[model samples]
Target: MGVEERRQQLIGVALELFSARSPDEVSIDEIAAAAGISRPLVYHYFPGKQSLYEAALRRAAEELATRFVEPREGPLGARLLRVMKRFFDFVDEHGPGFSALMRGGPAVGSTTTNAMIDDVRQAAYEQIMSHLDIAEPPVRLTLVVRSWVSLAEATALLWLDGREIPRAELELQLVHDFAALCAVSAAYDDGMAAVVVRILEQEPLEGPFGELVGRLMAIAPTVMEQVVADDRTA
Candidate 1:
């Protein structure tokens, strides 16, 4: 392999090792053996184990960050669903590596690693905010957005940990939960309420939001009667 190709090959090997285990658990000698090269050759590309670990993480982080980006066009719910699918796909492909990166297991946790993780979190948050085209949002409005972002991260981790739930169902449920949160947040904040109203107005009836609103509208009367009857029973 060419020099650059060899470097990437080494990184690929390192990433596989990292995914299977942890940073500290994988040694320089093991990496060299895995790559079928001498220890000195591995050192030529990466100074040591830490550099190799960080390089592997940086690659993963870049790929993970890219998955969060989706076209800003179309309904907010549609856009979010697309983004959520990309996010989950990454989790499915790199569940162990992702878990280590996000949760900072003992072997990989450190100041530098945590800082890198924070950068990925901020990038995902900014991607959502940028697409929303929000400016000077009220405190509660911003809080709601941030909360959803955090929830998405936590939910992905949990979803990976327990495979009992199908990914498609999780994605749809998350989208619905976000819509529900918006409705709840809007009830407390007129600013958010107005924003949501504008979004609903602009949303095409064939999109995710449209489907959600139509379904909820259809079920509202029955749901409301059930709630009232339950209250009476209590």
Candidate 2:
């Protein structure tokens, strides 16, 4: 096999083993034995078990990211539903692979994998914000995007660990939960807008509160519109 092909073969073997057991539970020797190769050959491909686990995780994340990337110009709600369906479908088909990727432990032990997880989180955030019609400066918007992504990822991890629900059922629950959050954010934005309007009318300028309120005010209408749209479609 070519270099890339050989590398992929090793990754495949490692992932299969990882799905059945924790990353640390499967030793390099065990992988070599499963692949019918000597332990030294395994070492040549992956310096250690950690390297192998990292590669397996990268492989899974890349596969998932590819599955979700789609045309971005359509209505935000439609795009989100499409992406969510694709995502949950993947979870159904590749549950073990994904579970292994996320369940792999502390970031401190493997900075590379930690960064990889962060990348996955960021990508999901972008996907969601894209679907939310968020069109603010990237730096300013990161906080909102990051907060929503945390909620989604945490919910997904919990579902992954505990439930074996069918894809359709889980998708319904996700859409319902997200729709509620969208409504709450929309109402908060509207209230902020009223505060900003009060400040702009030169009635009172409450320093940081005024500035913060103004920012939320600017996005309030757009957020409400997006929430209405998502509720209808989702």
Candidate 3:
């Protein structure tokens, strides 16, 4: 293969290995063997395993960042659900590599790796904000968006371990979680309330946010009954 072709081949091989296990567990010899080349030839293309890992990480990070992008033609809740599905698709495919990138072990702990992770977070944040279509978002609105982004990252990292929760359920729950966050903030801030109102205006009863409303409403009578009983006792 040519020099560029050889480098791309090595990166592809390394990414596959990294996806199966943490980057630290994979060695130069293994990468070279996987690429069907000598260990020294791997060095000729890249200086060491660290460089190779970073290259693979860059590719993964770029893909992960793009997962949050969706066309702004649907209800916000639906848009978010589609984005979540794509995000989980990446996590499901690159479990070990995603974990290493987010959790940070000795092998993957470097300035470059951390920056890539941050870039993914920022990209996700910007995408959500654009979906909101707010010109000047309030401080609380900013907090809600950024916090949801972090929550999504943490949720994916925890889900990678054993994956106890059904993936589809988690995806829908995350959409609900975003709405809940905005709703709670909206209660206190007029700006946030306007944002929630605008989002709900575009939502449908069958959508995730509307489903959350239905679920909450279903238990409202029981909750209110308990509250009335406690008030009478008091």
Candidate 4:
């Protein structure tokens, strides 16, 4: 193989192993063994174990960063549903590696590792915000976006650790959670309220927002009935 091909072959082998195990647990010989190559051949592409680990991480990180990049031309809620589906798909495929990337435990983490992870988070945040078309969002709006991004990361990590929650369930919940946060932010802050209303107004009734709004309407009577009954008793 050519020099570049050899380097990528080794990196690909390292990625598969690293995804299945942690950095400390994987070694140069193990990677070479998996690659069916000599130990020295592995070193020829990467200087050392640390270098190989970083390369593997970078490979994963680049793919992850691209995963969150979605088109801006769809209904906001629909776009979110698309992104959530893609997000969970990545989680399902890269189970162990996905968890390691999100948590960044000190055991196998360094500045480079954390930076790559952060890049994924930041990319997700920016992609979501980009749909809003706001050059500068308010403090509360920023809080809503940032909070949801962190929540999504934690949710994905938990989903990896405990498979009890189905991926589809998590995906649907995240889509609703994001809209709920937006509506909540809008309720407390007029600036946020206007922005959210504007986005939701553009959404068609057949979209995810339509379904969620229908659910809200269907339950409104029951919720208001309890409040009214309590007021009458008082």
Q: lDDT score, residue 124, model 3? A: 92
For model 4, the stretches where C-alpha displacement exceeds 4 angstroms are: 228-234
How do the candidates rank by lDDT, highest first?
A: 3, 4, 1, 2
lDDT of each: 0.82, 0.63, 0.91, 0.83
Clash tally, candidates in order: 0, 0, 0, 0
What is the per-residue lDDT of model 2 for residues 87-130, given as tens digits with 9 covering 90 to 100? Answer: 77666555555665666564114678768877887788766665
Worst 10 residues of 2 by lDDT: 203-212
TM-score of 2: 0.68
Which of the two, 1 or 2, has more lDDT?
1
TM-score rank order: 3, 4, 1, 2
Q: Per-residue lDDT for 21 in model 4? A: 75
Clashing pairs in 2: none
lDDT (tens digit, per residue) of candidate 3 on 1-234: 899999889888988998889888899999999989999999999987789989999989998988888999978889999999999999999999999989898868899999998898899989989888989989999999899988998998899999999989899989999999999999888989999999999999998999999999999999999999999999
Which candidate should be chosen as best, given lDDT against the real structure? 3
Using TM-score as the yardstick, the better of models 1 and 2 is: 1
The positional error of residue 37 in candidate 3, measured at the CA in angstroms, is 0.8
Q: Which stretches of candidate 3 lie over 4 Å from their true place?
A: 231-234
Once fitted onto the true fold, the runs of candidate 2 whose alpha carbons sit more than 4 angstroms away are 93-97, 106-109, 137-144, 162-164, 191-234
lDDT of 3: 0.91
